[model samples]
Target: MTTANLPDLHDLRERTRQFAQARDWEQFHTPKNLAMALSVEVAELAEHFQWLQTGAATELDDGKRTAIRHELADVLLYLVQLADKMQVDLHAAAVEKMALNAIKYPADTVRGDARKYNEY
Candidate 1:
């Protein structure tokens, strides 16, 4: 999808920066710390689905869904902070990765296949 279809990531990044600065948290928001926090948030998000048989959208109750949403927000916040500290443009990196992925996994050749790019 085009960036026009995306939310204002730059705005989000600025907001994250302001939030950390206001709290004097920048000293703690090193890329390594942010990465670790991101991992923890991801694990929390995953825990919400740990026991689900299929982990389908329909499988989540309202409370569980709400918890998952908060976990996801935490993950995004950490990622934004991490990108800022690491001097990386998260959206641009994602777009570049998508381009690389297209080269690595051509749709026509990998259609209905579940193998690694190198194996294909």
Candidate 2:
């Protein structure tokens, strides 16, 4: 379905559940496997920019942009699917994780610093 016509997260999760069940794929979608798949999709997404010239990369035509967008959506879909499979609230988890990161790397302390979080 088009993203503009996409269902809410709960509905999306249910749809994914039904899809997986129909194909008997739920057993194959273990957390570890799903996580690995997500990582692979992310790598593929990154590959789109492997060696493009600075200006050329940003000047992608409609078709190129659409391809990149599809790759990005693939990555995100797998991510959300994984989260749903694990019964984790993706949005809440993201917000909570970012909150923890903020404490771990307070902007004032790390503003101009180039150190890792542990070093900060």
Candidate 3:
């Protein structure tokens, strides 16, 4: 779908589910497999920036950018699939995690610092 008509998270998840079901692939989409696939996709995404200078990754050529985009999409798709299989709402989990992170790394104290939360 076009970016202007992009589906919501739930819709996207449902599409992914249906795609897998059509191929009878759900049996291979266990949490473990999905998580591993996510990890591999992330690594593939990282490979595009493996030797780039600090900020160069953001300035990729069209071809590289497209490749990175596909890798990122793959990672996201697997993550959504895994979360669905585990009966977790990815959006809710992310929000809850962010809330905990805010407490662990209070902005006022952590601002401009790169240290771990325990060091703040």
By TM-score, the best candidate is 1
Q: What value does the lDDT take at residue 104 in candidate 3?
A: 92
TM-score per prediction, in order, is: 0.91, 0.78, 0.90
Residue pairs clashing in model 2 are none
Give the Cα error of residue 113 in candidate 2, in Å.
3.9
Candidate 2 wrong stretches, greater than 4 Å:
1-7, 53-57, 112-114
* Predicted candidate 2 versus true structure: per-residue lDDT over 1-120, tens digit per residue: 654475577666777778889999999999999999999999987787777775275568787777789999888778888998788998789899999989999998899998998875
Report lDDT per candidate: 0.89, 0.82, 0.87
Order by TM-score, highest first: 1, 3, 2
Model 2: per-residue Cα lDDT at residue 108: 85
Error of 1 at 18 (Å): 1.2
Look at candidate 3 and tell me the lDDT of residue 103: 90
Instruction: Name the candidate, 2 or 3, with the larger TM-score value.
Output: 3
Give the runs in model 1 whose Cα sits over 4 Å from its true position.
1-7
lDDT, model 2? 0.82
lDDT of candidate 1?
Answer: 0.89
User: Per-residue error at 94 for model 3, in Å?
Assistant: 0.7
